[model samples]
Target: MQNFDYCTPTRLLFGQGVVEKLPEVMSRYGKKILLTYGGGSIKKMGLYDMVKELLKEFTIVELSGIQPNPKYDPSVLEGVKLCKENDIDVILSVGGGSVLDCSKAIAAGAKYDGDPWDLISYKVKAQAALPIVDIITLAATGSEYDCGGVISRTATNDKIGYVDPLLYPVVSFLDPTYTFTVSAKQTAAGCADAMNHIMEQYFCEDSTILNDGFMEAGLKSLMVNAKKCIEDPEDYTARAEMMLTCTYGCNGIYSLGNSPTGWPLHGMEHVLSAYYDITHGVGLAIITPRWMKHVLSEKTVDRFVKYGVHVFGIDSHQDPFTIANQAIEATYKFFESIHIPMHLKEVGIDESRIDEMAKHVADNEGLENAWVPLLRQDIAEIFRASL
Candidate 1:
């Protein structure tokens, strides 16, 4: 185990009808609220009315139409403007991870005088930020439990994961009932996203057995429950488990004593999502197995063997290389079985921009420092294989 310091201060009110506690939670942060959501899905599901009725005593400002990838220009800028102009005391993000992610930027930017991009890009550090509370409707990204979010600059084709301790949500209301209406496509993609989070930590250079066991169980649970979710979106038990799994995904808990892998799959997929505006989790699903194959070698075969045997129940009697290859194939097939588009071309990406994305990922994401360091050529090859 490695030395570490960790804290997750977000108060979680989990289970059905938990959003009814919104009024009591919001009271601690004052009455002026910036309500953030995406695409009006909350309204369609009647969650908007439920939240509004609960918080009827409070003043509210709406920042709607936040996208999946969560753009910086309109969403972040408009949110910041609302916060500053209204003296917003707290932000209530009432949608998926992207809304909460945009709210994080807005929360920080509300305190800063300069452009929010500087803070998001790490050009400037945040000293203070507005308090954030969220009702997560999607199981992906895990932004509600983490102090980080991926933000995209569409014009520049740049997507950056921004993290600051101050960005953690003050409160997160997790009612799995809200996710009961999630589509099969998103449920599968969300599973892929959360699973990749574990693999990112599991494949590291140094780790404790405790963490490895936790990740292995998490991977298995996600794979099993993700299929359940696809078969029946209303399975409360499966939805709750998957939601909790995703909540733990990106908060550094799984990687506490582990050496960093630099999250190379995310590094590669960020370019795909940023360039083509594809779904974030879908892009991750497409890239993960390809990256796994590219990075496989003698040094990494042991990890793959353990993953195959423990997570997939692959027979352990086989040679290490065959086990590793089987594990990679199983991963690909799992995503495919869950209905994620398994190829970049299927998602409208082609060779024309492979070189561009590889170069961009190399220059920006620093994949060369990943666990199995990847050069631009290596990343390009993985991209081609994914295609």
Candidate 2:
């Protein structure tokens, strides 16, 4: 086991109808609330009205249209303005992880006078940030449990995973009922996103047995229940388990005391999403199998074998390489089975920006830290393979 220090300060209220607890949770922070959400889906689902009715006593300053792969431009700038002008005491982010992640940035930007880009770029540390309370509607990202957000700078095609323990939410409300209305496409993509979160941690060179087993169970659960939810959207048992698995993903808890594998999949996918605004999970699904193929060698084949037998139930009688290759094929098939786009062209990403994206990822994402270190040419080749 690796030496580590861990802490999760966010208070979770999870279950059906737990969203009604928002007022009680927000009351502690003060009345002026900066309410943030994405698009108008929440309104269409009647969640907007529900939240409004629930928070009738508090003044709500709304920030809407925070896009997927959340942007730092208008939302953060506008939020900072709202916080200053309204004297907002707290941030209440409702809807998916993007909204919550955007709100996390807003919460920090609200307290800082300098350009918020500094914080996102890690040019400086966050001194303090507004208290954040979130109501999650998406099972992916795990931003609710973790103190981090991935924000995009459109001009630079930079998607950064900005993390700061100072930005941990004061409260997070998770009700699986909220995810009941999520579309099948997004539901599957979300499952893929969460699963990749575990794979990134589990595939690390320095992992312990404890985290590998925990993550294996998580992967199997996601695979089984994701299919169930896809086959029957209203299956509570499947939805609940999928939601819980996603909740634990990307939070570092699944691999607590486990060593880091450098999160190379994320490094590669960040470029796809950052450059083309592709869906994070779908990009991950497209790149993961190809990345596994590229990185497989004597040093990494054993981990692949374990993943095959443990996660895929591959029989051990076959040669390890054969078993490993089958496992990668199965992964691609699983994502395809879920109707997720499995190729870069399928996602509308082509060769136009591959070289640029490869260079950008190499420069900024630290892909070299990967278990099997990937250089710029290696990243470019992986992108080409996905193409």
Candidate 3:
């Protein structure tokens, strides 16, 4: 076991009909509110009307049109303006993780006079942020339960994952029913995303059996429930379990006492999504197995063996290298089985920018601390393999 410290302060209201608790949770944040959401998804689902009705008593200041991968330009700037002009005391994010993530950035920027990018780029620390209360409609990102949010810089092709303990949501309402209408592709992508989250943690250099067990169980749960969900979108039992699995994906609970594994897959995928405007989770799914294959070695082969035997029931009698190779293949197969594109070309990501993205990831991302430290050349090779 490694020396570590952990804490999670987000209060989760999970299950069907948990949205009914929104008014009470919003009440503690204050009267004036900055209601944040994405494009018209909520309106289409009638959730927009429901949330507005529930919070009818509060002074609602609306800030809509947050996008996936959550840009920092207009969205963050507009959000900061809204918070400053309305003197908003609370931020109520009502869509997926994108909206909640944008709201988290807005909350912190509203309290700071410096550019919000300063906080995101680690040039400045967050002093405080407006309290956030969220009603989550998506399960993939885990931003609702986590203190961090990945924001994209459009001009620079940079996606920075900003974390501040102060940004943990005061309350998060998760209702699986709200996710019933999600498209099959997104559902599969979400499952892959959650699985990758656990895999990233489980692939750590410094780990304990306790965390590995938690991560393996979480991965199995996501794999099982996701298949059931894609087959029958309304299977409440499967949907509920999958929702909870994604909810716990990135927060510190599973690896509470373990040292940070440095989330290398996320580091690499950030550039993919940030540059190509791809779905964050989908990019992760495409990149993970390739990263695993590239990083596997004498030192890292055991982690792959454990993951294969535990998560996929791979034969234990095989040589360690063979088991590890099969494990990587199994990961790619899982992504493909769920109808996800396993290659970058399938996703319309051409090879032209591979070198550029590799350099960006190497220079900007914190990959030196990864379980298998990666260099710019190694990153380029992985991107080529992914292509």
Candidate 4:
């Protein structure tokens, strides 16, 4: 096992009516709130009204319409302006991971006088950030439990993962009821995203047996519960378990004392989402199996064998390569079974930009340090295979 330093400070209130404590949680921060959310889904689900009614006494400054693959240009910039102008004390992000991700960037930017991109791009490290309290409406990304967020700059077609411990939400309200109304497509995509999060950590060079068991169980649980969610969106037990599993996805707890895997699939998929504006989770699903196929070799087949035998319950008494290949096929089929568009072309991405996207990922994503050590040509080949 690898040596590590870890801490998860985000206070979680998870269950069926946790939002009832929203007012009490907000009281610890301040009265002036910078409320951030994506489009109108919150209002449609009546969460917006409930939040307003709960915090009627607070002075709210709204920064609505934070998009997925959260934009750094307008959303982060505008949010900083709102915080500065209004002297916002705390940020209330009441949507999915995208909203919370955007709010995290906004939180850091509000404290710094320089451009937010400086902080996001790591040109400048953040010293402090305004407190963030979130009500998670989706189970993907696990941004509520972690300090990292992926921000996109469309002008340059750049999507960067900005991580700083200062940006962890002070409190996260995770009520599974909030996700009961999630659409089938989104629920599948969210499941795909959370699964990839575990896979990224699981496929590393070194890890504990205990960590592998945790990830294997997480993958199995997500698959079973995701199907149940598709069959019945309001299955409380399924949603609750899926939500809790996902909350641990990106927080590093699942991989404690484990060697870093370089998160190579995320590096490749970030370019897809950055260039095509495709769904983040869908991009991951399309890239994951292909990446797995590309990276499988004598050195890595044992891990795949274990994954296949443990997670998918494939017969382990076969050739190791056969087990590895079977595991990859099973991953692809699961996403397909969930009705995710399992091809680059299915999501409006095509071969035209494949080379360019591949080069960008190769240059910027540091895939050379990945578990499989992919170079430019290797990345391009994986992209073509994914197509």
Best by lDDT: 4
Query: Tens digit of lDDT per residue, candidate 4, span 175-247?
Result: 9999999999999999999999999999988989999999999999999999999999999999999999999
Taking the tens digit of each residue's C-alpha lDDT, what string does model 1 give over 249-314?
Answer: 999988797888899999999999999999988999998898888888989999999989988999
Q: What is the lDDT of candidate 4?
A: 0.94
Residue 74's lDDT in candidate 1? 90
lDDT of 3 by residue, 1-387 (tens): 766667889999989998988888888879999999998889999999999899899999998889988989999989999999999999999888889999999999999998988988889999999999988887788888899898998999989888999999989998999999888888998898888888877887677888888889999899888999999999999999998989898787778767677888999999998889888778998888889889888998998999999888999999999999998998889888999988888878999999999999999886877878888998899889898
Q: Give per-model TM-scores.
A: 0.99, 0.98, 0.98, 0.99
Residues forming the 10-long window of minimal summed lDDT in candidate 3: 252-261
Model 1 per-residue lDDT at 157 = 97
True-structure Cα RMSD, model 4: 0.7
Query: Residue 25 lDDT in model 4?
Result: 92
How would you encode candidate 2's per-residue C-alpha lDDT over 1-387 as one tens digit per residue? 789889999888888888878888889999999999998888988999999999999999998999999988888788889998999999999988999888888888888889999998999888989999998888888999999998888888888899999888888888887888888999988999999999988887677788889999999999999888878888888888888889888778898887777788898898789888989999999999999999999888999999999999999889989999999999999999999988899989889988888888899888787788999999999999998
What order do you get sorting by lDDT, best first? Answer: 4, 1, 2, 3
lDDT of each: 0.93, 0.89, 0.89, 0.94
Off-target runs (Cα >4 Å) in candidate 2 are none
The RMSD of every model to the true structure, in order and in angstroms, is: 0.7, 0.9, 1.0, 0.7
Candidate 3 local accuracy as lDDT?
Answer: 0.89
User: Over 4 Å off in model 3, which ranges?
Assistant: none
Alpha-carbon lDDT of model 2: 0.89
